[model samples]
Target: MKILHVDTSITGPASVSRKLSAEIVEAALRRHPDAELTVRDLAAQQIDHLSSAHLAAAQGTAPENAQVREDIAAGRSALEEFLAADLIILGAPMYNFGIPSQLKAWIDRLAVPGATFRYTESGPEGLVGNKKLIIASSRGGFYGPGSPAEALDHQESYLRAIFGFFGITDVTVVRAEGVAISEQARATAIDSARGEIAAIAS
Candidate 1:
């Protein structure tokens, strides 16, 4: 199996999502001992945000500058990686009630027409339905079902929606919420998430 592990956390070692994602990857490795792993750190190696130049380039126009050329190549590379992976493990931390900008930029690269999805007479259809997606989600406050701030949760919800649009129905989330409530809350959340992660390989 080929596993694409993506980390979008900017907090480095202090990122709960990152730690949980690594554990999830380890569990996946244990399950598929010979699985090949590819890691993409968006924060460290950022993908340029989509632009008019990128759209023009996609339409067979040459990039206006060297930077645009490089950005286009990076976007293509990102899309290829997504297409090549059998499974994707994403470490996504909530920032201001939404996902980080870096993660959004990466998603933009993957949402290519006719590649990951296409228009059908019945409407839109996703082409990449065979791969599995597992998300390691970390939030500063409680945003799960029935939480007062649940409506404010655009992080996991958006991820689910986008991947669903890509035709990936086998989506799993291991979430560590309320981490910023207190140190004890953070520890408890992480522990609970780890417990959930234990079931991944079973």
Candidate 2:
């Protein structure tokens, strides 16, 4: 088995999402001892945001500039990494009720039509399959199912929807929210998320 771990936190060692994501990957390794792992630190590597050149290339237009060709190649590499993984672990932090720009850039690269999805008579069909996705999400405030802030949770919701578009519905989201509220809450949330990881790993 192969696992792709993508971390998009800019908070460095202070990032709860990064810590939880690492723990999640550790758990997966415990479950599948021989799993090969590939880690992509998006904040560090900084995937390029889609430009007009990429848009044109996606539409099958020939690259007129060297820079455009470079962008297209980079996008293709990112997409290939996603497609080759057996399991994907996303370390995502909520930024203003949505995903960080780094995560969004990675998503833009992978959401290539005819590569990740297809339009079928029934509807949009996902091209990627047989893989599991685990999202380790951190947020500043509590946004559980019944909470008032639940409606503000576009981070996980959007990820689920987009991955589903690619035919990956077997997704598990482990959230550690309210970390910025207090140290006590941060500890508690991390512990709770770790317990969930343990259960999943077993």
Candidate 3:
């Protein structure tokens, strides 16, 4: 199996999502001991936001500067990595009730016309449906099904929508929410998420 491990947390070792994602990756490795793993830390290697130059370059225009060329190449590389992976382990931490900008930028590279998705007569059709996606989601507050803050949850929701748009239906979420509520709450949430991971591993 080809596994793609993507980490977007800016908190380094203090990131809960990072810890869970690493554990998920380890479990996946144990399942497929010979799996090839590729790790991409978006916080460390930031992909530049899409600009007019990037759009123009995508339309067959030559890159105007070295920076544009480098950025465009990076975006292509990111898309290639996504396309090559059989399973994806994503570390996503909520920031202001949404995902990090770096992760969004990486996603933009994947949402290409006729590559990841296409417009059919019926509507939009996703091309990359063969891959499995597991999200390690960490949130500071309550945002589950019936929580008061559920409507404010754009992190996991957006991730699901985008990946679904890419035709991926085999998606799983291991979430640790309310981590900032209290020490006990944080511990309970993490312990619960670990339990879910244990099930996945088994």
**Model 3: per-residue Cα lDDT over 145-196, one tens digit each:** 8999999999999999999999999999999999998999989989999999
- lDDT of each prediction vs. the true structure? 0.96, 0.91, 0.96
Off by over 4 Å in 3: none
The count of residue-pair clashes in candidate 1 stands at 0
Number of backbone clashes in candidate 2: 0
lDDT of 1 by residue, 1-202 (tens): 9999999999999999999999999999999999999999999999999999989988999986999899888889999999999999999999998999999999999999999999999999999999999999999999998999999999999999999999999999999999999999999999999999998878
Q: Where does model 2 exceed 4 Å of error? A: 61-65
TM-score of each: 0.98, 0.95, 0.98
In model 3, how large is the Cα lDDT of residue 22?
Answer: 98
Alpha carbon lDDT at 158, candidate 2:
94
Model 1 score (lDDT): 0.96
lDDT of 2 by residue, 95-188 (tens): 9999999999999888878889999899889999788999999999988799998999899999999999899989999999899999999999
